[model samples]
Target: MAFSSGSTGGPMANINVTPLVDVMLVLLIIFMMTAPMMSYPIDIDLPQRSLNPPQNLKDPPPPISLRIDASGQVYWNNSPTPISALRNMMETEVQRDVNNQPTLEIDVNEDADYGLLAKVLASAKNAQMQKIGFVKK
Candidate 1:
């Protein structure tokens, strides 16, 4: 603490920020030293090769067409198929080609029941069918 020599004022009280700056610097250094040790390397078995090939290399399999009419009837490949058989049919197709799965193209009528469509989608998913698409028309 220093006293003012001027005759106007006695001793000026001022905040000493040097100690605060020193404490902040010490904390910053501590954090910097410990931050690197906090992170640990994790090991994971990542896939080395992509399962799918380039699109141009091979011809894609023909998509299986599934249609839902306004009367809530489901058709597989233009033939009437019962909802109960949908899962079996999809599983058969998957079993036929283990490497290449057939894509499913669904055509739902505008007036078709939403529940029917949902059921069909759920069935396809349950059978582990991945490539499902919707037709605009």
Candidate 2:
């Protein structure tokens, strides 16, 4: 809030929200005042719980490390893998357990090729990978 003793008002460029805030406050007070006075009596009958055995929950599969080196070579779990096989690999991993697909965590070298990265992402997208993450270093 700015208050000036000297008046130099020549078509103010800054917006003054005092009136808007005052209106909003009045509306809020009105709503608050009226909200508690108009409550209608209603009954809610809650349902009883039925006895049943809880289903077993399966733990999620581990995340797979997908690394890319500066030379544009790809690695699946530290083993050399070709870019041509990326789509198939992603599909296989995803299909391994349909309910819970393993997340692919990419850890790439700083000098890794951007084109290869794009291709990898494209393959992942094509294979409909549910989760893909990036790992630092």
Candidate 3:
């Protein structure tokens, strides 16, 4: 706090901010000194290499293309496939290893039956197919 150097000295209307700025700078310095100590990263213990590594790590199987036409007819890889066979196909595909489960890409026409689409999705889920996907076209 400071008063004006005038003939009739009184309380100053404006505040002195130098002390406030000094205090803020001291607080900033204290935080800067302590921030690194507060943020020590948690250590991660990794598993040692297994004696038997994975065998025959070939590429994953190719994706299967499924298309549903406006008339509710299903096509498996561009060939006409009955809806009843979807389950058997899905089950056989899911027999692959988890990482090798082929992606089922389904393309549904705009006017396709929603019931058929739901049935297909339900079948995939029932078979525990991990990588069923829908195509835009």
Candidate 4:
């Protein structure tokens, strides 16, 4: 018995995937060749500490709040105060109730002028208010 091929688009034959496999293999090889160079490696060596007991330090408590609003305005403990009057006020406050434990906490809004903030910090430092810190609000 002889078998006859299908009609229409000539003899119906199984598609050979060899060419497709070869193309895919070549692409994979090309990608492999370029991949290593495409990516760079980073090497880092972290510092190691000696095995010893850590020293303990007491954290100061929340300080007196000094707020600076966006318009370069200063607030002494939430109340607006003029820059001309700030230094004296801070001095007085720091000296208030000697046993009050002096510490100044300056909180500044994000839009507040940094120059004004620096002046505030400078005033605090000049007044000898030892502990000063800034808080974002």
Which candidate leads the pack in TM-score? 2
**lDDT by residue (tens digit), candidate 4, 1-137:** 23336466455455778899999999999999999899978986565886984476355444677888889888877788898888897788667644444577788889978889889888877776766766654
| Candidate 3: tens digits of C-alpha lDDT, residues 16-78 | 789999999999999999998899788866668899988978787999999999999999999
State the lDDT at 70 in candidate 3.
Answer: 98
Against the reference, the lDDT scores of all candidates come to 0.90, 0.88, 0.90, 0.75
| Candidate 1 lDDT by residue in tens digits, 73-130 | 9999999999999999999987877567889999999999999999999999888887
Model 2: residues with Cα > 4 Å off, grouped in runs: 1-55
Task: Please state every model's RMSD to the true fold in angstroms.
Answer: 9.6, 11.3, 9.1, 11.4
* CA lDDT, candidate 2, residue 135: 94
Cα displacement (Å) at residue 26, model 2: 31
Write the number of the candidate with greater TM-score, choosing between 3 and 4: 3
Candidate 3 positional error at 5, Å: 60
Compute the lDDT for candidate 1: 0.90
Model 1, stretches more than 4 Å misplaced?
A: 1-58
lDDT of 3: 0.90
Q: List, residue by residue over 1-137, the lDDT tens digit for candidate 2.
A: 45555577444456789999999999999999999999998896565786974476578898989999999989999899899988999999988987679999999899998989999999998998978899996
Compare candidates 2 and 3 on lDDT and give the better one: 3
A best-first ranking of the candidates according to their TM-score comes to 2, 1, 3, 4
